[model samples]
Target: MSETSALSATGATESRLVGVTAALATVCIWAGWLIATRYAMTSSFTAVDIGLMRFVVPFVLLAPIWIRKGIWPKGLSVTNGILMIVGSGAFYTLMVASALEFVPASHVGILLPGVMAVWAVLIAMLLFGERPGKVRIVGYAAVVVGVASLVALKPAGVISDDMLMGYGLVSAGAFMWACYTHAMRQSGLGALEAASFVGFWSFVVMAIIALFTGTTIGDAPMGDIMMLLTAQGLLAGCVAVITYGLAVRHIGSTGASAFGAMTPALTALGGVILLGEPGNLALVLAVVLVILGVMTASGVFRRARI
Candidate 1:
């Protein structure tokens, strides 16, 4: 290869390396956050309380920067700001947290990302005129089927019927999150700016709610409060969003999201090993279908072939 070509190849390799590393980090944080959210839900804290802890610290920490940058991001549209609130802000937090009381984190890991990926493609088609290839459509179909089977089928008694509500809520949350992903992609904002946008607006929504309904923060145990503060507030709320934004920077939004196909495996294992949650062949198969489908829908193999 010519010297210039070699230099170009080296730059591409480094960029991919950085993107992959960031994507991997985002996946780990997402999995841990699922596990931690599940643990909190099973304990004394309500989902609302979890939401409070999740955004409180992030809001406070990012406040100084956001105050200077102003409330709305410089170039972000009003529509995207609204969609983002539904996606990563108050609505997103409450939906996922509420589901955790009934849904296993393993199921969450598999289902939410799968559904979100499908929604992303659908939204892209509707809003941007983007079309998925046949293979990608097939992958989307697999994700839908996997989600259905996971929710409706329970031959081995792996999933509880009571969890149906949880599954429904998660599917809805995935749609909202997909909207958030697209908004983030179009916003032309950096990682920190995106984090601040979601954090500030979401905090406004939640603060309004707390005023009317009151808060459970004072009633919860200090240890649990502190634990969730670190888990939901710092790591999941601020750090994960920022890190995933970095992945978006390096790899493009679509590629960064494909890394979410890894989430089910991580959270499923984390649930089984760390939390002693039950797992069986049925759950395993469902997770496989979801992962494989998302990978294909993401054009991961197609791009690799090129």
Candidate 2:
């Protein structure tokens, strides 16, 4: 090949590598967030308090971005803005925050990847007449089966009334996330714009709730407090969101969501390593199935257009 052609190929390969690295980093960020959120829950923080902290950290970290873009949205409507805010902001945080108190974040880390994908696909089909191909259908089925194994058919001793309720709530939270993701995609907001708006509105609502409830805010040991806030703001909030937004731009929502399926297994591993949680072989297998099923459903195996 000519030098020009060689240079072109080299650039393209670099870009692809960058995308993969960024995507993987996003997954790791998510996994760490789950673990930290679980630890933070053990403190005096209520669900809303954690939610508030999550946003507060990110809000401060991203203040420059907001300042550059300004607080006000240029062309957003009241209705769409509200939907975006409620869907992505308060409800999403509330569900996940309360969930960490009850269920292992590893469970959530695993459950959400496929759950969100299946929710988005099914909702779109039912609401908009979009249909999954045969591969996608089987993939979706695998996800359902895997999820059942993970949540419903765990060892008999593991199931309890409270655990079941927590599972149900987290599943509902995942559904809300699916709604939020789909709505934001359909809302015609630029990715960065939507992310900034989400941060802003989540901050607004979380602040309101925190003030109204008089919930204690970040009163833990200063190190723990700083660590949680830093994780929330830097890793989970700013970095993960930006990477996820960019991944969706490069790979589209379904593909990015599919790649996200690996997070649960990673989260489980992290929990085992960091939190000293027992790793069950059966749970590991189930999480693997969920991740595989999501990848299959996402059609990432198909060749990308040049």
In TM-score terms, which candidate is top? 2
The root-mean-square deviation over C-alpha atoms between each candidate and the true structure, in angstroms, is: 2.7, 2.5
lDDT of 1 by residue, 1-306 (tens): 999999999998999888889899889999988999999999887777887888888789988868988888677789887887789889999999888888889888888899898899989999899988899999999988777766434565466666888988888999999999898777887667777777888887888888887887898889988889998889887788777877888897678867878899999999989888878776788888998899899887777788
In model 2, the runs with Cα more than 4 Å from the true position are 61-72, 151-154, 246-255, 304-306
lDDT of 2 by residue, 96-188 (tens): 778778777767777777677788897899988998999888888888887777644456647777667777777777788777767776677
lDDT of each: 0.85, 0.75
Per-candidate TM vs. native?
0.89, 0.90
Which 10-residue window in model 1 sums to the lowest lDDT? 151-160
Distance from true location, Cα of 74 in model 1, Å: 3.4
Residue 210 displacement in candidate 1 (angstroms): 1.9
Candidate 1 lDDT for residue 296: 90
Where in model 1 is the C-alpha error above 4 Å?
A: 1-17, 151-153, 156-161, 249-255
Cα misplacement distance, residue 199 of candidate 2 (Å): 1.2
